[model samples]
Target: MIFMNMIFVDREKELQTLMQRLNSPTFELVIVYGRRRIGKTSLILRAISGRNDSVYYYATERNNLERFREVAQRKFPEVRYAREDWESLLHFLRDKVVIIDEFPYLIEEDKSILSTFQRIVDENRDSRTKLILLGSSISVMEDVLSYRSPLYGRRTASLKVGELKFRDLRHLGFSVEEAVKIYGFAGGVPMYLTRVTPPFLDWVNRELKRVDSFLRDEVDFLLRYEFREIGTYKEILRAISMGKNTLAEIRDYVKVGGEISSYIKKLERIELVTREVPVTESVRSKMGRYVIRDNFTNFWFRFVYPNLSLIEEGTYEITEGEYANYLGHVFERICREYVRDRYRVKKVGRQWWKDVEIDVMGLGNVKVAGECKWSEDVNPHSVLANLERKVERLGHTVDRYVVFARSFSTKEKMEKAELVDINDLNSWFMS
Candidate 1:
């Protein structure tokens, strides 16, 4: 029930693309689906806002066919409920924008509804109207609208919206450090961001108390709503969250034997997790590791779920004390993310070497490594020496070796190696 001003950003291009598609003379059909709370509905609303054409947005519910008929009758009063054919539904509208949100619910209630929609779209293919379908259930969306289904090739365009990027966190008033922490914990979901408020500790406290908080129950809801194999999905997520990143480790932890292979395929299809192979010469090695695709989920699994007993026992104060001991390491990881994001914005991709990983590498085709020291005193000499060894390990000569420190690096250190101070860091991200 927590609400705030609907801050819309970062989807201007998507909206423009949809607008252009809708303006075409030929009848258009678009399918949009994504993880829940990723803002599919918001995107559609913003895209069509202030348009001259009539737009009807309907959300299907978990109900019987009679209930759907009643709801449809109420929404489209001009269309007679007695007429059950697809043509009647098509004839009811003219030159309008038709949006069906949660269309899968209707399809689930009555499988015939898919054919009905297909028939209607076929009859109206030459018309000026546009039909846009939205669904949050990834499985249903893929099965019904994907190329393998009957509705394959029927959609004019399909857009799969993903979570916001860490670089985009600044729009929400988060400093580089705060941005990384928030990104690692809450992630880039708009709904999650809405819950962030002043006195950051208070916001975190409130979220911990709420049973319906997205952090606590989103995984459960997603599994229940989207997949039939809830037990298997839960086991897989639990294994990943518990740091079983390797495929063999996951299979061993889940103890699914023969079912483990199939479960992994299913999880990948829904985009809940991904497998990461080392960026090395051995591209075909089966040495890949699994990672939860969403940052928030990863953090929740790592920190929150592990300490649920403490939270439920009202011993969070003691638990927070334990958390404080490791806060430095956590903050250091956040600092690395800040540097990595800056590198990406600067178009410097990742590079790795055996047993040595640079925080920021391949900066503008030059090998660079950095250490983020949030403390007031950053040992420039140690960091510089580390970078020197890393470069040696990488076996590359670099134009510059840079160290990014939140505080000031000594003048002598700057003279020795390229140094970016806190002010420079701020400007780099701000620009």
Candidate 2:
């Protein structure tokens, strides 16, 4: 087991929001949620660190009213054990900040927990106590906050904690190119990145190629925990990671009979997959394609999962050979995400014109279009001309055309567009 030092990176904004809620004059019921290992518990603990009146309870599958009261009494010794309901518990301990972590586990054990919470929240409307409920399952969290739910419209604040940004990884002491490679493998999940040390490729090789590796079983565990149709989910993810992005294409590849929208939606809710259309297209566009949004998941399906037998035998020659092809897509995704984060564009996505496609395009105050090349050398003029033609073919005028490449040969400058090599990624982030 590789033990990583617990390091808290950037959550300044989230902390500020939570602090603001805690200091509010009225009662506040806040909902915080995200996928597993995205630092939800760490964020909450950090937010409530110095508070003396805070009570934190981690609900488990076996948790009941008695279990809750037992935990609460640990923090507040004056509480009586006779009260079994949440309402009585809250009334006894009113005006004290409380946090319930893994709240979905409690609901799974007792489905009527929401109704009980609804009553507590209603009675505590004028009280100054702040109640926070945190969960990892996105679908269950949404169901608890939905209009049909008893607790709907009762929360004073709701926050969906997302993955850390690429720019934030600069604190990890990696150069632009190295950070790109690490992000390609681990994305921004704190728990995933914790296991990664220096010498990125060596770490990658051991984690993915070795039998009995923790990461080898992570995806399977995550899917099986949240979904019932494990086989169908695996097939669907494999199809998308292998480049079958469209609904029709994925359905054909999986050969499942039922409607795939629900499965895909479930994946999306858990932050595993994303549905994207052209930047110019509307949200209702039928031209959307689904892609596995998690970098680790994408990399696993593409390289590790398919070659499990070979990996088990301690041979990774085929996987190592195909990894270069896999990095091409990673490079494109990094470039597009960088443009979106740095440029603050209205829209950033891939643009497809029939058979032609531009890898990254930004439409905003300054229209920008780009192509990513994970090659030894890139010809700036040829790449610029191709992008120009594609922009023209799409009947769109771009204010700036950028080329992202590993290295450049000409040592030349362009009058129409900009050439950005791997070294310039840091400069872009700073800008």
TM per candidate comes to 0.83, 0.93
Cα displacement (Å) at residue 39, model 2: 1.1
Model 2 Cα lDDT, one tens digit per residue, 1-431: 22122335667778889999998999999999988888888888888888888888888778457787888888888777446778888887789888999898888888888998999999999999899999988888988889999999999999998887777677666777777777777888878777778567778777666667876678887786577658888889999998999888999999998888888888888889999888889878887889898998997887778878877877764343465667787788888877887678988989886788999999889889999988768888888888889989989998888899988876467776778887777787554
Task: Return model 1's CA RMSD, one decimal.
Answer: 3.8
* Model 2, TM vs. native: 0.93
Residue-by-residue lDDT tens digits, candidate 1, 8-63: 55676777878887788888888988888888888888778787564444555655
State which candidate has the highest lDDT: 2
Model 2: CA > 4 A from native: 1-10, 209-212, 317-321, 341-344
Candidates' C-alpha lDDT: 0.66, 0.82
Clashes of 1: 0
